[model samples]
Target: MKDTVMGTLSQRLEENQIQLNQLLGKSTDLVTKELQLDSSTHIALVYIDGLVDTQVLHNSILYSLQEGAIQDQFKDLDPFQKLELLRKRILIAGDLSVTHDFKQFVHQLMSGNVMVLVDGTADALRIGLPGWEDRNVSEPNSQSVVRGPMEGFTENMRTNTALIRRKIKDSQLWLETFQIGKVTQTSVSIMYLTHIASPDLVQEVKSRLGKIDTDSILESGYIEEFIQDKAATPFPTIYNSDRPDTIAAGILEGKVAILVDGTPFVLLVPTFFVSFFQSSEDYYQRSDISTLLRFIRFLSFFITLFAPSFYVAVTTYHQEMIPTSLVISLAAQRESVPFPAFVEALLMELTYEILREAGVRIPKNVGQAISIVGTLVIGQAAVSAGLISSAMVIIVSITAISSFVIPESGMAVAARIIRFALIGLAGFMGLYGILFGVFLIILHLASLRSFGMPYMSPIAPYRSSDLKDSIFRFPWPLLKTRPSNNKIQDLKRQDTSKREGSAYDREK
Candidate 1:
């Protein structure tokens, strides 16, 4: 069986069918139709049902092969000549390739291409006729924006690549594709700007992908887990988004994008800690508004991370930090509660987390309603029952709302998980523990790298040029250089001297 797999195809069509059958087993969806071109010549059309376009197979291969004097002309020519005639004259396929190895042909067949096998020929023709139903490009539920392109990536890899290509039309915008999964044979593509992206970075990305030895790649998340720099860390080293504009912007900044087949999410490599806070909409809006929104996202990040812990630390150990009136109010609120400040905050946070998860897992039509109503009812009931304090509920609610302010869900999730640990620390060792946890988090982030680039870049390492777009996005004309963190080949993004209105224009 191993020798046969490595060997080239045979001139006998029946034996080829046996080899394919042995390899593919008795799959009910695998369609094999034999065509008698003439009295002497026979050919087989093999493809997976529901994958290939049946209409095209009927009109192009079936009708064209059986219709005219085309069959009569095949009698005089040899098998090789006959196959050439079918390819050059008969088939109306836009893309087709000829292959001798059975393994290659089978891969193409499973990929929705129709395989043509001739009786006296050693090679087969694989015709491109992929046609399967997929969701139309719709607004990305994950990364929706008030202003920007509404068309998100579909599950179809080609459609996703085309969407990015539509934005960046330069020849330097190149894409390379390879199959990763052994059993699934999923097609994964890496896209980058040829002239702007560093050669070393592109090679490193390809090397990591090529090193992935897995049997199945079901989605982009599978690849993300496999190729990420640090698996143990809660923070996502690689960024993923369904928005093409976001992906295009990343590629423009010399980052590589990994697009997996059958998934809408595309992974961007060398993603900095600050990248998660930034959104594609930031570029669409004015610089000042974008800067203000970015500051809010950063502020929300800190609030989500430290709000509950801060409240816990102060209420549990350092009551002097709060005003006399506020402290008296908090004491009154907690007078009926049996649990300590730590337990009360923990219960409320856990309840909110459960409700938030339920909102995600449940049906979309009622998920939001369920989460909102469930939280309110549960919180009010818990307060009435004296199980949790009102102050704890307010803190949990503020933390939950702040988590949503983050643009990237991956980062938001990381912050949410870390918030629990910080809350636990605050419960045990007061403000000191929360401070220690934060210090350790910063150290961990500083040590982490995303494909050789620092996870916390431009800020920790202090690249003045790249800082223009890190925490605060500078004006469009002022952002004249690409991000220096990627070690990009091309440093200058735009020639500011060509601007219609600027200091450069005034000098001109």
Candidate 2:
């Protein structure tokens, strides 16, 4: 029975039921309803329990089919014609389709669609009635903002796409969907502005997505790993955000967004290195304030990436870089500590990372208490026991706080991992090693590409027109063009107009 392949529905009703039961392993959720059609013919409705809405199934399908009008309509028709009549006129389900392929019918049935089979018909009617519990849309836990829209994406794919649609209600905002993951069959959607997005980049993204042959794509992270350009690099070539406004902004900027089912986070492609430092709030604030915040973020990024490494380099190798008084103070503090500068920094950084991970993985109620206790006990005990220096603790704490200033978590994670490498290099050769490491990182970033767009756009290649929105965003009036790196079809984002009484004279 397991080896038997299902074919066209047999004239015998019992055989069809047996085959369906065998295919579904006779699961308890496999519900079958037998309804008599007049005195001669019968129909079997098969659907999974807890998947379909019972009210919809009863009112739209069962009630309509059990009516005397439907029985009269099907009384004289043959089984094949009766199936067509039921699908076309009798079934009240909004989404109705007919399929003769046994495999397709089974798949549809599993996907929360009711399959209708008549005794002598070779075809089956698939009625869409998917009803599954899902979480309500709420504020994003990861990317909260003070000035942006509070609504975040939900796990439902349709709802997520609809959220984007609500923001940019343009027909040009196109969505192309694909089903990846052979086993999970996760629905993946690629969204872009058809006129603004580059066709070549879009095609490249599509090609990459089509090439994914994984067994499961449980989250956007899985797709990110499969499609990213520099898989070995710690820096994320692709950006992901749970905020719909963020994804919409990416689309309007000629980037493509991939929305994976079952996850709120959506991936944005053709992302530049500078983009990770930006937040949606940047656009909401005054340009001057935004520019200031942007500069602060860049400064924080440098501090996070190089603070520990620079400490190791200066304390262990080049004591002259710091003031003589501060150097004396740091040395006096570390006099009782037995570990080297590298070991001390590494131990404190690893301890912070462990606490951070535990806070994230543990339950919400107990996580804060654990993290507070762990940090207090570890920091205080380490300093008192001379396992690490007080200065090292302060440096590590500052570095950790600076890491939180970066807007994107993936880029922050890359910085965190790279911080250890930089620290190791600094320990080896002091300031020269740190400079060498920074040079290599810059070179690697310049060489990287995301969907054919340079990772370090508007800076490495030096597009002055696009730089207005890079490190420091110019006023909206001065910013009238889209990013040149994208090479989109429609370049001019908005028309520029000269102010009547501006400082500079208006040219004809």
Candidate 3:
């Protein structure tokens, strides 16, 4: 059947019913309950079986339609008037919409809404009683904080948006919704502060989302990959968080947040390189503690990216650079191993990666224990069999631990990939190769852009004002302005002139 047949509904409910059934392909879950209101009026309630609230349908809507009191009012009213009367006074559903198109009726029916078709009316009422099973709001698994809001986003987009609203609670906070995915017709929404986020940024984000022509958007990650500034780069140009407070904070800082249905992770745009190391907990804790943790994260980034490669480079080409005794000890440990430093390190790293992947794929109850035991046993056995050196094991272990210290898994994964590339470079050209790799990495970071903002914002572009919250967060009283890199309209974050106490009285 052509869409034209279902595009416009007839005055007769029977024709509309046939067209709706044709559009729906008469699916197994398509439910239709026929009801008679007095002598002249007839209505059909169409909805998917599992998607709608059966309790609401049976207790409120059906009971009201079948009530003797309402039957007297419907006797003299026309079909359209009857629908109007039901919509204005009788329907007990919390949310309702009227639509004239059959296509919209099918869409609403698919989205877990009940559609009511009157016998002689063209307009139908769409009841919002969606009752799909969803996971309750829970603590985030990937990004947990020692001190901050414990609640995280749920898979439902409406629930996620509510969580953000609860955090910000400002009138300027706005949300724009889009139905992407040609087939799935997934609900996607972008939220930002009207006064804080730049108008151009908002329009640009809408433009990118409009241009996407995919058939399905299953998760927020799908939108991220499609709309990111650069697709080929290992470093993520877009940042995502499962915590609502983190997203709300981003919105307050002039970043737009993308929320997709069926996903807990919400994406924040115009992310800078330093953002990967920063956490929501940083703002919750004292400035000094956040600064220390921030410094440690930066240190961990370097260690995770360079530890194994640096070890390989030094042992292969700069053994003299090490202390004399340590060099002798390292050399003695490696003497029994058959492979060269690079090969040995590569084998150990690959083994660790395998074990790490296995731990994630296995049952959660024993995953961590299995991975740890597997690593220890494999490392000791490799050394005992002279297949690898003890020094290489220590380097790999340190590198693994350091990688976990980075807050963002995406950034940590990027470092891991670059680590392997650096290891290969060291295997061929030693320390000089490592230096060359680092230079290239820095150059790439400098060139990268996240939605037209520099990836290495405060560092590469050298914004002094923004640096207050970048690598080391300055005190709340001292930090009075929002990040300048975002070019937001509202720059003042707090009133610096009103100091609360003499405890922060270091400067005039």
Candidate 4:
């Protein structure tokens, strides 16, 4: 007992119990029950209180061992033989493993597994009895859809994986598990299609995950930030979703998904910039309608990013670009405002952002009402008080509304941050500065990579094959091949012989 916890088990049972208590600090929840097999052998059960199922412990392990018939069978065997018999015949649990390492024993015990140690054996049996509380599967709040699966991922990793497994039942679907975080020992899992995903990309993902040596990983964001390609850029290289169908779709597209234990959001790797604009409902609805909606989203992205900056530039520098009547109206509106165009735009944008954040942070019952009424009242008051022009208010409102059109919040936030920088540049150098900013932004996007895949794939490098599903999605019948930009091993998604001719051609 004095040497180390890793030492071989002593023939005396009391010494083992004493060493376990010393290592565990004799916590109140650490239950250790001692039992005797006739007059020769002894055994102990060690487990945490709330983590284990008491009903199973009583009816499965304790009741079976306390029976006279079971004790009679144990009396004829040695300690090692008795332990083997207990594991093979006695335990009613589905999963059980034998471990000799002291560190692994403690780890299993803390993870809600019951440990059974014999009087004279070095190895111990770990019984699975996890009974922790968790939320039930429900609809996703962030990425809701009009026509698709309503079921979303819960905090449980097994449940999340099962959700995906239920959707895609292919034999080639592979799942690999890892234990990260030295202190928390969080369970992480990566899943991909064996036939579709690149083996090199899988190896690179495993290599990066192995390099993480932090003390804790509370959320998937921690892993995302640690393993992403560019840490300096505002653009997100990794895509995250709480919908199982979305994750399953990514797997089918030759992408890998990382599922963390304690969070519902799963991270998808090798994501392209176009993915943020796509939604789960896109594939469910008609391709023509989905394509039109996608085009609107793309238009809204630019409007959200450049609306205020364009206004500032046109008013302060390029007045000739505006029509005579519209210019007269804009000039008349701003005549009452004391501040310059840039200052007025900045002030309105900041105020709207504050109100949006306040609405989110407040209680849900009154939050929406307050945000709506607050915006209307504040806008009217500012215009009447001559604090900001009515035209500037309208511009900020349109810009704010356009931001909600983007499917992903991360990309929308990047647009919000870049908008201010564009506004500043426009204030000094006008339209030329705005053009320069757009060039630099595109340059940065072209330079970024996610797990060796181009961030602006099928656009910057210009892949004609991938354009079928880029800005506008083609019909499902026409999309017979996978994206070539991902460099996947499999190129053909379906057989072209199954494809039929269009209705017009058939009629002719």
lDDT of 4 by residue, 423-489 (tens): 9999989999999999999899999999999899999789988998988888787787899887899
**TM-score of the candidate numbered 1?**
0.97
Residues 1-508, model 3: lDDT tens digits: 2455456678898988777776768599999999887779889999999998899889999998888898888876878999999899999675988998776666778899999999998899999999989999989988989989899999999999999999998998898999998778899999999999999999999999999998999999899989998888999899999999999999999999999999999999989999999999999989999999999999999999999999999999988899999999998998889899999989988888899899999998987666656876899999999889888888888888888899999999999899999999999999999999989998999999999999998988999888889999998877878998988989999875566555665563
- TM-score of structure candidate 2: 0.94
Ten-residue region with minimum lDDT total, candidate 1: 499-508
- Clashing pairs for model 1 are none
What residue pairs are clashing in model 2?
A: none
- Candidate 4 ranges beyond 4 A from true positions: 1-15, 365-373, 500-508
The reply for model 3, stretches above 4 Å from the true place, is 1-6, 500-508
List the lowest-lDDT window of 10 residues for candidate 2. Answer: 499-508
**Per-model TM-score on C-alpha atoms:** 0.97, 0.94, 0.97, 0.95
* Per-residue error (Å), model 3, residue 167: 0.8
Ranking by lDDT: 1, 3, 4, 2
Candidate 1, residues 15-127, lDDT tens digits: the string is 99998888777899999999887887889999999998999889867988888688678878999888888888888774877999877887888899999999999999989
- Superposition TM-score, candidate 3 onto the true structure: 0.97
Report lDDT (CA) for all predictions: 0.90, 0.86, 0.90, 0.88
